[model samples]
Target: MERTLKLTVAYDGTEFHGFQRQANALTIQQVLEERLAKIFGHPVKVAGAGRTDAGVHAYGQVVSLRTTGSIPTDRIALAARSVLPDAIVVTAAEEVDAAFHARFSAKSKIYYYRLDTGPVPDPFLRNYAWHLADEPDAAAMHAAAQRAVGEHDFSAFRAAGGAPVNPVRTILAASCRRDGPLAEFSFWGTGFLYHMVRNLVGTLVDVGLGRINEEDFAAILASRDRNKAGITAPPQGLYLKQVLY
Candidate 1:
């Protein structure tokens, strides 16, 4: 009998192209599927809750797969971990309802972006955080972030080259805070566009740097033009923090 398994996964993503499988490219999904297929002695199709961009880490990524193997669901994570690279780990696994899907069933997602606002970059954080030469105004960034909350067209923050689709999304929370040399941006949303959070952070950083005021930020958002927004922040600073069911 085929059983559906849900997995809570975490990965460094430093060496991955992204979460999706690509032709002749290394990816988290590719690695996971390869290892899982080896374990089951058959091809396996793994689906993820989100396709995190290259260099973006994840702490609570969810994945689902159907398999005919007789391995105990509770021990599947352990068996998978024995073969997966150190960078990727299956933290938990369980049999889920047949109708449950990792991506389509998700109700919301949370992402966090980290910035090191220190003059001297920390070597320890080189692979995990974006480094800025100087600290930006946290208060200003936080205030600007509020503009992103609530439902709106997010074309200004969406990256190019994506398939045409509705640009509107609902943000439940958006905030920025600073702790010593670390600056963090947190976003909770029903859904996000391509590179939306990164672009939003980039624009908010501009506000923090005094390049744009709150009113200007609001206007840019209302304009729905990508050119009005700032550059896309580096993917290293981004993390898929959670996926709510």
Candidate 2:
């Protein structure tokens, strides 16, 4: 019997080109499909909850696929372990209803961006966090982040290419805080545009750095022009933290 299986995945993302497959690139989806094909004895395709950018990590990325393989859902992760690379892991797996689709069934997604604000960068965190010698004001960034809550047109924060047709999205929650040498930004939303979170973080960093104030941040968001926003934070600092069903 064919079954729809849901898998919770985690990956370092340091070596992955991205979560989506590309014609000439090594991607998470391509790697997963190849390894899963070996287990299923047929070609496999994966649907990911989020198409995270290159070098963006994940803690609880969700994916779902239909398979006729005899392997039980409980053993899927273990089976995957033997075939998958060290950077990617199937943390959990379970059978789901046939109608469940990873991307369409998701109600919300949470993303986190981390920054190392210490004068000296930590060798271990170099691949996991963005190192900044000049620390921004976390409190100011937190204040600016609050303006993002609720539904709005997010065109200002989107990247040039591969943007969604609809520019409006609802941000459920947002926050920024500092923990000693590390600073973290959290965003929970119904959906996000390409490079939205990273662009927002970059603008917030501007506010924190005194280049822009909270009101300026608000105006930039209202402007809805990508040129008005700040830089796109590097991919290594961002992580797809969770996907809500």
Candidate 3:
């Protein structure tokens, strides 16, 4: 019997190339599908909601796949645990309607980026947060982030290659805040282009550092030119926090 299953996953991503299956390098999807195929006694193709980049992490990444295996929904996680690595965890599993898809069926996604602005880097956060010796002004970043809280052409924020067919995306909300030496940024959006969040964070950090003001940020958005944006923040600090259905 064919059954569709939805799985909520979390991963460190420190060692993963990305979420998609690659021909050579290791990936989240490849590991997941391989492990699942072992339990199901058949090849299983798992589809992830997002193709997070190398070194990026996830707290609530969602996936779906069709299988003929008889494994009970409650036991899927346990079964997967036996075969999967320590960095990947399947937190929840359940049977869903066949029409469900992990990507196309999603409504929106939330992403978070963290920066360690202390004079000294925290060894514990080496793989989890971006450490900057020079502190950034969180208040200035917050103000600049507000300018992105609406639908706009995000061409200026996208990476050089792999441009999406449409450069437009809706940012439902955006905020930046700091506590002590840690600065966190949150973005809720209908969709995001490749490296959009990281690029925004980089440019916003420039604003925080006084390299660019709010006016320049606004002008960059209006120009829709990638050259006007700042550097792409490293992937270690990025996280796919949640996907809203």
Best model per lDDT: 3
The residue-by-residue lDDT of candidate 2 on 138-180, one tens digit each, is 9999999999999999999989775358999999999998987
lDDT of 3: 0.94
- Tens digit of lDDT per residue, candidate 1, span 1-245? 99998899999999999999999999999999999887776899999999998899999999999999888887788888888999999988989899989999999999999998888999988988889876789899999899889999999999977779899999999989988888999999999999999999889889988999998999999999999999999999999999999
TM-score of candidate 3 relative to the true fold: 0.97
Poorest 10 consecutive residues by lDDT, candidate 1: 127-136
Candidate 3 per-residue C-alpha lDDT over 1-245 given as tens digits, one digit per residue, 9 for 90 to 100? 99999999999999999999888999999999999898888999998999999999999999999999888889999988999999999999989999999999999999999999989999988999999868999999999999998999999999998745799999999999997778999999999999999999999999999999998999999899999999999999999999988
For lDDT, candidate 2 versus 3, the one ahead is 3
Q: Would you list the clashing residue pairs of candidate 1?
A: none
TM-score of each: 0.97, 0.97, 0.97
- Candidate 3: segments with Cα more than 4 A from true spot: none
TM-score of 2: 0.97
Q: After best superposition, candidate 1 residue 119: deviation in angstroms? A: 1.5
Residue 86 C-alpha lDDT in model 3:
91
